[model samples]
Target: MRLSDKVVIVTGAGSGMGRAIAELFAKEGAKVVASDISEERINEVSTSIKEAGGEALGILANVAKESDVQQLIDRTVQAYGTVDILVNNAGIMDNFIPVGEVTHEHWERVLGVNLNGPMYASRAVLKIMLEKGKGVIINNASVGGLFGARGGAAYVASKHALIGLTKNTAAVYGSKGIRTNAIAPGGVNTAISGTITAPNQLGMEAIGRAGSAPMGEAQEIAYAALFLASDESSFVNGVVLTADGGWTAH
Candidate 1:
């Protein structure tokens, strides 16, 4: 139980990497506040955690909204009294359109959720963390942050902006005992709304395109997150740790 007795807030905890991260943290003994836009999914996650004899509170929150973000932090504080770890995992992808083909609405929505959402959620906890004299913020960036794919202009833009924000926070807050970092993960089998067809096909493609490096499991990223949250990475700050399956190694 690396996180035993500590409080954690995980956004987008209803599914995918967020859910896996939340469950892992709770298993390691953290009191987790799991929030998602959907109340049903949020409660389902909470219930599963509780069934596993872990502590969790389900919250319905839209990470892109300032009010909702604030409420997320507030509710966590009220439930577990203080937040020690925050996983900014709530983000939406662009509809895989070229920049010329993308609508303004699509771009704005993607940025709002993927880039601004992390900013708002991190800001919400900054004061509390500053007051407590220590905290960890983990922003879930993507390979999109580092490379421009064929039709991920909006995703690329948003992630690049998020990297900037991550660096800024780490630089500004490291001295105050706050460690801010980001993870750029490669393809993982998650519920990303219908593009991913075959599961093993993804792994096969990853192995080939990424040159034999396997596409990571959500648990792998969760392990990295656990390390970052622990005192193990106390000296580490403002780092963008890439967990891509050697995608950018070339």
Candidate 2:
């Protein structure tokens, strides 16, 4: 019951890390808002949580859209009265396309979901959180945010920017009772890899040079996120908690 009565919004909650985080939060007594672009997936997660005797609401949302983000927050407040935590977990991967060959469409799409989505959600939630004088924001960043060769150009750039945004938000709102942090996961077992249908040779070669690291489970990252969302991490803020099993150590 670490998060008893707390209202948490988790984006990309249909599957993988997001779904794990959403379910875990609910188990800890949080009223979870599971948001995703896919209605079917959202319903599945939400239903599972409810079946477990936890509170949950499934919201269909495409985080890339500003209007969607606004509506998400508005609906959460309407349902739960206020927001306590926001997890920006929705993201897409670039198909290992280096900058030289990356298309404008692909770049924009990746950045839109990975970066702009978090920005919009954070901006919208600040009003409620500021008034409450306490809030937590956790961004699901990646090792790509810390290193270059982990992903394609756009994906790397977006995650890097997300970490930056996390720090900046913490700095600006820390004293006002807001804690913002990020999780830089290495290789997690998620459907996001399915997006890489057409891999770029150079990009793949660059990653191959780094060698392979042990793949992590979605629940491991979810546990890390759970720590961030709970009071255990009250003193932590603006930190990029790397949960990659030391993949970047070497």
Candidate 3:
């Protein structure tokens, strides 16, 4: 149990990669706070963890809301007394609309959940982490963050900004005992794709290229996240670990 008794908060823990991360962490002896926007899903995940003899608390939260994010951290402290790991994994996908076709409303909404959500969560958690003089923040970025064409304008921009945030946080807090890193996942079999609208010409081309690459399992990403969250990655900071299956190699 590498995470033995560590307090971990995983956003979007209701399903997909987030669910995998939470379950794996609990199995590894972490007290996990499983958060998601869906009450039903969150409860299901928490119940499963408890049935498996693990400690877990499920909270319904819209990470894009600062107030909700604050309540999340406050509740975690109330239950666990401290925050050890924060996994900013809750995110949404935008229809693969090109920059020229992306609307302002869509852009704001996408950035709100994918970018501002993580920022809010990180800010709320950093206060407690800084006081403890040690903490780990693992953000779920995308290959779109590393390269264009993987996502629409808003999605790509948000992830790229997220990577910047990860690096900056690590640089500022590494000396203070906080480690921040990101995981850039390529194509994973997840529910996020269900939100995609019709693809544009550029998006279609990217999709074609993606079709040749192998899709990774949610557990594969959870495993990478687990390593980054555990003490095994104590010396690793400000890194964007690409969990994609050679999607970027081309």
Candidate 4:
């Protein structure tokens, strides 16, 4: 067990890659804190983990809200003593509309969740990690962060900003025993696509041309997270691990 006795917090653990990561971490002996906007979904993931003889705690939270994120950290500490890992995986997709077609509402919503959410969570967790003098943070970025046209203006902008955050966090805290990294996953089969509008469907289809690698499964990405969260990645920091199936190879 790579993460035996580690305390891990995985945001957006209600479904998709987040959920898979939570389950896998639990099996590897990490005490998992599964948080999501949906109470039912998070609870279900928590219940499954416990039933399988793993430790878990479910919390309902909107990562974009600082209050909710703070409370999440407080509760996790109260239950588990301290946080050892944080996976900022909770995120939303934009409608894939170009900047010219994007609305102010859409831009704010996407950035609030995709960018600000990670910042809020990282801020809350840093206090604990800093005091302990050791921790890990893994941000879920995307190929959209690496290039244009993979998603809408808002999504691309938000992800790119996230990569910046990851680097800054790593630089400022690496010597303090904290590590931060980002994962840029390409086309993983997940529920984020439901947010796509009809007009933007064409943009989604164009993803096929970017990579010959098959669309990734949630578990595939989860495995990547596992490595970053574990002791094996102790020497790795401030890096963006591209799990984009060769999308950027072009």
The numbered model that scores best in TM-score is 2
| Cα lDDT for residue 21, candidate 3 | 98
Candidate 4 lDDT over residue span 1-250, tens digit each: 9999999999999999999999999999999999999999998999999999999999999988889999999999999999999999999988777777789998999999999999999998999999999999999999889888678788999999999999999999999999999999998998776767564766555654555545889999999999999889889999999997776786
Ranking by lDDT: 2, 3, 4, 1
Badly placed stretches (over 4 Å) of model 2 are: none
What TM-score does candidate 1 reach? Answer: 0.91
TM-score winner between candidates 3 and 4: 3
* lDDT pick, better of 2 and 3: 2
Tell me the lDDT of model 4 at 194.
70
**Candidate 3, overall lDDT?**
0.92
In model 2, the Cα lDDT at residue 38 comes to 94
Please give the TM-score that candidate 3 achieves against the real structure.
0.97
| Candidate 3 minimal-lDDT segment of 10 residues | 204-213
> What C-alpha lDDT does candidate 1 achieve relative to the native structure?
0.84
Q: State every prediction's TM-score relative to the real structure.
A: 0.91, 0.99, 0.97, 0.95
Alpha-carbon deviation at 85 in model 3, angstroms: 0.2
- Candidate 2 yields a Cα-based lDDT of 0.96
Best by lDDT: 2
lDDT at residue 95 of model 3 (Cα atoms) = 77
Superposing all C-alpha atoms, what RMSD in Å does each candidate have to the true structure? Answer: 3.9, 0.6, 1.2, 1.6
Q: lDDT for each of the candidates?
A: 0.84, 0.96, 0.92, 0.91
**How does residue 174 of candidate 2 score in lDDT?**
98
Clashes of each: 0, 0, 0, 0
